[model samples]
Target chain A: AQRVTQPEKLLSVFKGAPVELKCNYSYSGSPELFWYVQYSRQRLQLLLRHISRESIKGFTADLNKGETSFHLKKPFAQEEDSAMYYCALSYSGGGADGLTFGKGTHLIIQP
Target chain B: DAGVTQSPTHLIKTRGQHVTLRCSPISGHKSVSWYQQVLGQGPQFIFQYYEKEERGRGNFPDRFSARQFPNYSSELNVNALLLGDSALYLCASSFGTASYEQYFGPGTRLTVT
Candidate 1:
């Protein structure tokens, strides 16, 4: 079965400090990876996808197939960057085989 | 264009009761997927519908059912609901299967007591 894992339940980082939200997925072959974010009182939204290879909100994630991971990284954490981050894996199939999401990590940027 | 939308932003029901949730996909989107998100957990896949047909289903019980319409709208029905059903129900829409990424709605907060 396919699965996504986010080992950290909660992570605290001071402003301007580097931050990394760990994410690992279990899937066969090359898989699409994504990072979604949900701010307090806000709906979940797409932050970035590995296919695009583009950075959003200064956050970037590289799909490391060798490590079976796609960890979210940011050079300098900001107060506004604090939110719930989820790592998801998409399966290329028809039917209700939607994206498999991780348990999510609560990133708290301490001021 | 408007993003995906879901009705009944908040709902509260007692155990054993029934509840129905609705979702409208973004214009031009032919696929709609449903998920259940409990507090402090990621959303779990529930169902997927495309072109008014059931494409995929998750590891849910028969009590959980859903259908899509010709207009790309969808409804999720939960019969004999249980307390564990309390969670946020999110609806996502996409153009087609495969490489197309999904866009999500605000989600409906369902609370079963």
Candidate 2:
């Protein structure tokens, strides 16, 4: 079975502090991991994907296949970074069938 | 161009009633997918339609159905609604079947009494 787990339901950090949201997945094949964020009064949007290997809004995530983890990290957290984040995974089949999502983590950046 | 759009931002219905939620995909997008997001939970895939054909469906009952028009717009219909059916119905659209990035709408909040 394919599953994504976000252990923390809520996380809080002071501004300018580093932030890390943990995510783990269970899948048999190569997985495509993604980070999605939802801001207040805004629709859910893509934050970054592990395959892209590019940073978005100063946030980055690395896919560690050995541990089956794709953790999202930011060197310094900002108040605006407080939002609900979700971790998603897609198989390498190159289609819509592979996408699976985690429960979600709420990050609170306290000023 | 506008992003994905869903109609009736909020709706109220009773149990055993039927309701239809409409969605318009982003301009030039050919694939549309529907998801159900309950309170305090992540969204769950309901249906995926590309080129007016049903490509995939999640673990939902037949009481839930959907159709996509030639213009790529879509509608989701739920019949014999149960109290558990109350949720936020989200619509997402992408340019092609292979496009991994999907734009989502604000979603329609359905309240079943």
Candidate 3:
């Protein structure tokens, strides 16, 4: 069975502190991972994807295949960054199927 | 351009009643998917449609059904709704099947009594 696990339900940090949200997955095939964020009173939006290896809003995630982990990291947390974050995984079939998501983690950045 | 849109931002229903939620995909998008998100939980996939055909479905029960029109918009229908069915139903659209980036709508909050 394919599953994505985000152990931390809530993570709180100071405005200038570094943050890390851990995510791990169990799948038999190559995985395409993504990080999505939902701000208060706003729609859920894509924050970044492992395939692009690009950072959004100073946030970056590195996929460690050996560890089966894709942890999102930021050098400094901002007050506006406080939101619910989810980690999603999709198979490499290039099809509409194969996307699975984790339960999500709530990050609270304090001023 | 307008993002994905869902109708009936909020709905209240009673047990044993049936309900239909509508969604309009983003323009130029050919793929649409439906998900159910309970409070404090991640969105669970319900169905995926491409070119007006069912491409994939999640592990939901038969009580849940959906269809896509020629224009690529879709609707999700639930029969004999149960109290546990209350959730935030979300609709997402993408350019194509391979597009991993899914734009999500604000979602419809369904409350079952």
Candidate 4:
């Protein structure tokens, strides 16, 4: 079975500081990776996907097939960047099957 | 366009009772997926429906069932609710069965007492 692991339950960072949210997965084959974010009082939304290879809101995650990791990072964190981040994996490239999600990390950006 | 929408933003049910949650996908969307999110945990996949057919299902118990309507809306029925069933239920929708992007609804907070 595929499982996603996000080691950190909470991460606190100062404004403008670099941020990294660790994520690892256990999957037998290549899987599609994604980062989903949920802001306070807002619904969950997609932040980035590995296949796209494009940064969103200064956040980027690279899928490391060798290590089975897909860590989310940002060079400069803003106060508004604080949110709950979940790392998810989908066995099917197109997400037809469904996703296995990590417990999630609560990121707090202190001004 | 409106994102996915769920009904009865919140619900309270007694143990052993049955409850139904509704979801309406965004305009033109044809696939809907259901998830259960307990406090302090990420959402867990429950079921996925496309074109009114069950396309995917998670390891949830048989008490949990779902169906999609011809108009693309969906409903999740939970039977014999337990205290552990109290959580936020999120509904997501995409354009097709294979679409990678899914729009999420606000979610329904179900409390089983």
Clashing pairs in 1: A95-B55, A95-B56, A96-B56
Candidate DockQ scores, in order: 0.59, 0.56, 0.66, 0.71
Model 1, which residues run further than 4 Å from truth?
A93-96, B98-100
In order, the TM-score of chain B in each prediction is: 0.96, 0.97, 0.97, 0.97
Candidate 1 yields a Cα-based lDDT of 0.90
Docking class of 4: medium
Highest-scoring model, DockQ: 4
Model 4 quality (TM-score): 0.98
Which candidate, 1 or 4, has the higher lDDT? Answer: 4
Encode model 4's per-residue lDDT on B53-97: one tens digit a residue: 999998999999999999999999999999999999999999986
Q: For model 2, how does the per-residue alpha-carbon lDDT over A1-111 read when each residue is reduced to its tens digit?
A: 778999999999999999999999999998788888999899999898887899999999999999999999999999999999999876644366535778899999999
lDDT of 3 by residue, B22-109 (tens): 9999999988899999998898889899899888888999999999998999999999999999999999998787636689999999
CAPRI verdict on model 2? medium
Q: Return the TM-score for chain B, candidate 1.
A: 0.96
lDDT of 1 by residue, B51-71 (tens): 889888889999999999989
TM-score of each: 0.93, 0.97, 0.97, 0.98
Off by over 4 Å in 4: none
lDDT of residue A63 for candidate 3: 94
Share of native interface contacts present in candidate 3:
0.56
